[model samples]
Target: MTMTRRYVQDLQDGETIEEVFLLVDKQLRANRNADLYLLATMRDKTGIINGLMWNVSEESMAQISAGDHVQIKGKVQLYQGSLQVIVTRITKVASDNLDPEDFQPTSSQNVSELLEQLKSRLLGIDDPQLRSLMECFLIDEDLMDSFSRAPAGVKAHHAYQGGLLEHVVRLMEMAWRIGDLYPEVDTNLLLAGVFLHDLGKVREMAFEGAFTYTDEGQLIGHLVIGVEMINEKVAEVEKLTNEPFPVETALRLKHLVLSHHGQYDYGSPKLPMTPEAIALHHLDNFDAKVHEFARSIEDDPNTDSHWTPFSPRLDRKLFKGAN
Candidate 1:
């Protein structure tokens, strides 16, 4: 495979660099004098960087859009201890010349192995009905392929390819380890909830290029979509068994999907009402938050300081503890 000329992670302050990047975001903004400037967010598999081009007309970037491969000439500068580029010139390039793998962030874990682990846990559920429901999803080759490649989110926690699989499998492991402590918690129900909670993300996120939401994802959202998916699979499972799926069991499973977000402000249509639902909500939140914190520390550009700059998303600075 042909190598990338330069990656965002390799950029250094005060360096004059020329490279091609995936233009993941762009904005035409007005400056202090009301003059127009173009702000761009560029990316590669390694990371992303922002660039500013001064004195540019809106028409200058009229044809450029996010997801287009672009070539840029710029001088790297450290702004507030983070690197950004003072772009001299930028223009879109033909993707025919570039490899898509060089621009998309993929998970470090082996996706197939992660999928296998997920299967082993869900398939082990002793509840006959729950196991049958899981089998309906597991046997769908296309769904499993997308699930293995979908991101947990566009830019938060586990956002790379295969991230959904990685995040779900970790939640399963954590749920399994805590089983002894929460003896009253139904392990079968909790495990099924964990597996199904974020399953809608496979359709919600588009990872073929830049990670973005789909039309169904934007209009309907994942919580509702997840419940819809479960209902469809429940119908199939019933057909296979020639018996009705337990109504209460299906209701509890749907509750886990809808309430996993924990609160109305977070987009959950319903609050976690059951012990299993409550447990899934907290465990999902814990894993996502911890991953975000660790990524902030690892991706912080200020190597000279022990603390990362204030993150607007996190609402606080993270300490790296004296380099």
Candidate 2:
């Protein structure tokens, strides 16, 4: 493959650049002289850089739109220590030319391997009834296909295809490690909690193109949707076995998954009360925040360090050190 030119961070002052980027946002504007300006967010796998189309022809405005993949020739200039592109020339590329895989961020690990590892862990769960339910979801062909392509969050950690699997696998790993740390906690319960906690996300968030909430998502939300799935699946298991899992035990497991987010504001309608529930809440949030930080690191690799713009997830700036 031919090497594409670098963006502003990769260029020195007075050096020019060319690149392919996803146009995530776009708008036209007026200058003091009422001249036209195009404002947009351009993103590649490495990071996003704000761009401007200053004094461009009216004909150019007719061609560009947000979410269109485009190729641009531009000059790199530093503005207040952040990189900005002053786009001079542009070409709209076929969507296939800018592969979603090339631009969307994903887990920096093999997804299939992670899924296998997750399966192996599930196999080790000792609780027979919980094991059955876990097995059903893990092996459900359709569900596995969706898990393999869905993003865990729209813009946070594991936000690409197969993101849901990656996030769940990571959380399960943590839960298992916690089991090793505290043998008093029932490992089966912990494992079951980890797998089922986010199951509803498959239905809650539509993965048709980009990750966005479905009508169900806006109506029921992931928490409510999730608990309901667990209930439905649990009922399936009961039908197969001709009996129910212990009410108290099943309730505790459901409670952990339901309350893993830890607050109503965070989407957890209930608070985590059991030790397993408490552990899950922290681990899930911990993985998400750490993954997001890792994404921030991937941005502006040439810089020794700089304060990132306010992160909507954290509502603060992050700084990086020399790799």
TM-score of each: 0.95, 0.77
lDDT of 1 by residue, 257-302 (tens): 9999999999998999999999999999999999999988998878
Number of clashing pairs, model 2?
1
Residues 1-323 of candidate 2: C-alpha lDDT, one tens digit per residue: 23964533455655667777777667788899999898877766555677887887668778877667778877777675557888887777888645676666556689889889889999888878778888777768888777777778766677667788888888888888777788877778888888878877888887654456789988987777777877777788788788876788768877987899998888787999888888888888899889888777565333655666556657777777434
* Model 2 / residue 258 / CA error / Å: 2.7
Candidate 2 matches the true fold with a TM-score of: 0.77
Which prediction has the highest lDDT against the true structure?
1
Q: Name the lDDT value of residue 172 in candidate 1.
A: 98
Q: Highest TM-score among the candidates is held by which one?
A: 1
